[model samples]
Target: MTGRRRWSTDEILDTAAELLRTSDAESFSVRKLAAALGTDSSSLYRHFRNKTELLRAVADRILLAAMDGYRPQGDWKQRIAALALRLREAFGEQIELAVVWGRYGSGGTGSRLVMEELLQALRASGLPDDEVPVRYHRIVILLASLITSEAGINTVAPKEYEQGMEQFRVAVLGADPERFPALAHFARDIRPLGADRPAAFEDILAAHLAQIEAQLP
Candidate 1:
């Protein structure tokens, strides 16, 4: 890679996303990206207004990749469930990307497309028109909160801390039933630390959809 070579918009976004995935958001900057591309920071300004815009473009790329080849099938609940899982899978890869999305808001074509699909799925669920927006907001907020929680845990918690928590949970579950009856009774249903993330995410999405279904006429 030479500074003499001109980079296309797609190339810049792809490289930017790669940089984001490899590094933390606090350390990501237009200058850093330019240096990585063997170009000057000013060159990025032509494609993006600033670092925030560049990150948004990268986030859109991730969203598009996640939605690629995904078609909503089955009933509305099923369709929404599938879309939610796709959202989780897409942002789950890079926590910073998800955080960026929340900070800057999704204004790209990819965001619009996904939002439309989500609203359509919600409508198909037989939810009342007046309540659609409320439900939509709820779903979006839920996804963001869950992604943040999962990402924060991964980013801030060391392996030793996680292991210690697991050990404590085990100890609590193994306590005498006389003193910790509730813990002993539900021990089998508790998820261990570092449990299958995708599976747990899917379960959350499924439960959300089920709740929506219950509200339907």
Candidate 2:
């Protein structure tokens, strides 16, 4: 009992976060994390029971960090949109962890905060009790969509990302001038990633907000 543990959970989580930032999902491993900490996987297991538990804790830590300055404001719709955007930014910020929890469906306490606020926002709409659950689920789906998507792959896998970009350029940017008139006409605007993706997210969020507004008396 007198001996100090090799590494604390906070330290392990921080180190794991740093690894995930640079390493893609396929490359990141418990062995790599232990190596980074000048220890071994068993040492990490000493603190966490298993890999799934460790990943959930890491995702929880990142989610909590993403809410560092969050304070609810504005009306119901604005408040809901804000929560979505904040967590979207959070998920995008540490998507590797997001992929972990998304696969396992372990959002834990950090996601619960958003869940609570979203329910409040739906209630603030004054809709009948029957309507709230469905809308709440839709918003959660919108938020979770970023996890399995290609939104944040640029940081984790630059080479593969660039390759995908090149393929898009060939397909859309370099399409035939005559056979596909619409694509040729909007060639410049059809590029992937960049502002287009976030704009699309905004469009979806705005549409969802409008849906909520339409239901209000």
Candidate 3:
């Protein structure tokens, strides 16, 4: 609002979103951003109130990008799985941005809207309208949890994370060769860690969606 030169909101947002994707919020300061864009830091103030507002816009814009060009067909369950995977893939590409997303307004408008759209799709797919919201909440929780977990693992102690997964495997499937022979035998292969986790998450989510579809029909 202060500058004579006109810059579209989309342009500003795209610039900010790109920064968020590549750098941590702490590192991506307004001064540095202006330097990167070859503009004065004060000039950005015309487009955004402050860094917080700019970050919100960035998160929203990235969400829009994630949801864009997504055209779904076939059974709704398949479509939903595709949508979830697309979002996960997009977020995975920008781990820092994903962390921002996890922390934004308990994860912001863009995220909430995506879930709403998925809930509507579920309802259209024969799920009860009222039930859709709760079910959708669960799915988003799982998705957000996975993203947050990955972000945490990347930032914190990697060794502790590996240990935690090992413990989880023992807790969930147990280590009882006498009683749960198969789980005890296959536990190592069943609970993979580190980089393999995201794929495992997608597979588990897809299976859940398939089960929901199975229940519907």
Candidate 4:
């Protein structure tokens, strides 16, 4: 009976990764994955204890892919930026996974390695051991929160995301000139929201790194 199983765990994970490309996290299920493999759900259970475990593995797979083939380079700040962006790009490649990243958090060895790398980068920045915890927490939160939130803008549902963006654009365009001076004044310039995200992310990340640099010994 056990000899009937032909799929390897890696194969399952690979197929699951592909499944993530087309399906949002909300709709992803072990049963769906099994269906994709043309097998019963029990086949997956033979390899993964439960959905949560499989999801955790999937998250680690993403983190591992981000870390693989990456080498630390440049100044400490630049190194941090490169690493963060690498992680972001990995999620960006699979927009649906990025959409659900917030829910699972999905701690793994790869995630730990990323944090360790951050701590090392902080050390390179000349930050003192005493300040490591607070500073590390700030960097982690800044990178994770901003990256995932940006991904979630497209959300789990296409119609919902579109509807939300339309309402947001309407508000931005409709705000009273007197009460919302800055937004009103810049509304026209902000017309290209989609095009500005990369620049916005860069500017924000630059400011954050500068703040950390000021604290260095």
- Per TM-score, the best of the predicted structures is 4
Q: Name the better of 1 and 3 by TM-score.
A: 1
What's the residue-level lDDT of 83 in candidate 2?
Answer: 78
Give the alpha carbon lDDT tens digit for every residue of 43-157 in model 2.
8888888767777788787667666787889988888877777766777877676676566555667767767888888888887778889989887777677544534553536
Instruction: For residues 62-163, write the lDDT of model 3, one tens digit per residue.
Output: 577777876766677777777777777777767777776666632456666686678767887898777777778777777777775776556646688778
Give the Cα-based TM-score of candidate 4 against the true structure: 0.83
Question: How much lDDT does each candidate structure score?
Answer: 0.81, 0.76, 0.72, 0.79
Estimated TM-score for each candidate = 0.80, 0.80, 0.67, 0.83
- Best-to-worst ranking by lDDT: 1, 4, 2, 3
Task: State each candidate's clash count.
Answer: 0, 0, 2, 0
lDDT at position 202, candidate 3: 80
Clashing pairs in 1: none
- Per-residue accuracy of model 1 over 52-84 as CA lDDT, tens digit each: 878888888867887899887998878877887
Cα lDDT tens digits, model 4, 130-191, are: 78778888877777676777776644477876776788789889889999999999986775
Q: Which 10 residues in a row give candidate 1 its minimum summed lDDT?
A: 148-157
